[model samples]
Target: MQNSFVKVPLWLFERVVGFLLALPIPIYSSAVYGLVTNMRGLPHMLGMYIRGLYYRQKLGLMEPNVFIDQGVFFAYPQGVELKEFSYIDKNVLVMSKTAKVGRRVHIAPRVFISGGGDFEIENYACIATNSNIITSTEVLKDGARCSGPMVSADQRRVFRGKVLIKKDAFIGANATLLPGVTIETGAVVGAGVTAAKSTEPWGVYVGERAQRVGTRDSVLCPDN
Candidate 1:
């Protein structure tokens, strides 16, 4: 009699679980993953799987085998395309429009990228922690009245420019790549540097304003 009672509850529990599992992934994806984009504290493997589905179906364009870690936030994911084999570390924020993260790109933790359409990180690029890639900003020069997003459209004079991290480029921690600048293929932006202009291919930049301190040997960047 005791064995029969135990089997009854187990059977009911299995049926309930089966019913839940029968539901579409979209419903679960939206209900849970949509509401909690970060999904922090979830198992790493599970979070990656759920986020992969969410990105492909609802969030934005993500190629196969992309690893998007927890705590990442996309302010404008509709216009972003995450390329194949890319990895985004935790807590990174991408606020760009029409941004393309190229193949095998690895973005480290707490990096912030914001710009308009045409912003891109080319294949094999690595962005270190806390880097800021600001591709567009208000024209706050020569006593101009136009400035910032808060002002009216007519009053706002935007300084829009394209920022690109080319193939095999490496941006160091706390570095800031300014509007309209491109870190060319194999270039390295050193830690704490502020890049104000485009870098030459294979150059290594350092200091307050981008200065080519040396050249990164192309041999190390074999695929570049």
Candidate 2:
């Protein structure tokens, strides 16, 4: 039961938003996207709902009942896939060519997901606010690097890998998951941790370079 203040059908509105979302990425990724969705009250609600519906149609995959919040900054979203009951919070920047987001996933506000390769997030995963999942890094040749769109070919480098998060994983706020790392099922990353490797299943990890501390099942099933 979607409550709408406006007369337009949700589907119709979705289609309209889809059209806007399909505009050339590099140009309208920020401005038009923000302009349409940054309003308050009914307009904001409408914007959020319409954006979700629009992405569902335009993206590689998107399931039902997904709430995409206002001001979600998605770059190259054509290859991103989202599953059922997933919620992407406001102002989260997902810059991925092929990112697979799974069922019941909740991405908190201002998370940065940058994937040049395939980044896969499994079911029941929560990415907390200000976390970063980076699947690629710049490869500098001869100590040369490119800052903007204009740079010599020799200064350009794009190294890519996959980031895998198993089911029931929680990425803490401001955590950084580096390229080619996997967070196993039921693993908990403490806030401000920077994980550079795969976590043990159900393990609690914390610190700048995260290490396993305890098993999640101990707390989850205390009597067991």
Best model number under lDDT: 1
Tens digits of per-residue lDDT for model 1, 1-224: 25978989875764564345334676784566444466652345866765665566544577878888887877777788888999988888887776789999999989988755357899998999999989777776655565466677676667778889999899999999888898899899999999988999999988997888898888454553
Q: How well is each residue in 1-224 modelled by candidate 2, as lDDT tens digits? A: 45665545766776776787767688676565566556342335777665765576567788877777777766776787888888888788888678788888999989988857677888888999999998887766667685633676567776788888888899999999988899998899999999988999899999887977888872353311
User: How close is every model to the real structure, measured as TM-score?
Assistant: 0.80, 0.78
Score candidate 2 by lDDT.
Answer: 0.78
Off by over 4 Å in 2: 1-34, 40-44, 139-151, 218-224
**Model 1 lowest lDDT segment of ten:** 14-23
Which candidate leads the pack in TM-score?
1
Q: Every model's Cα RMSD, please?
A: 8.3, 5.1
TM-score of 2: 0.78
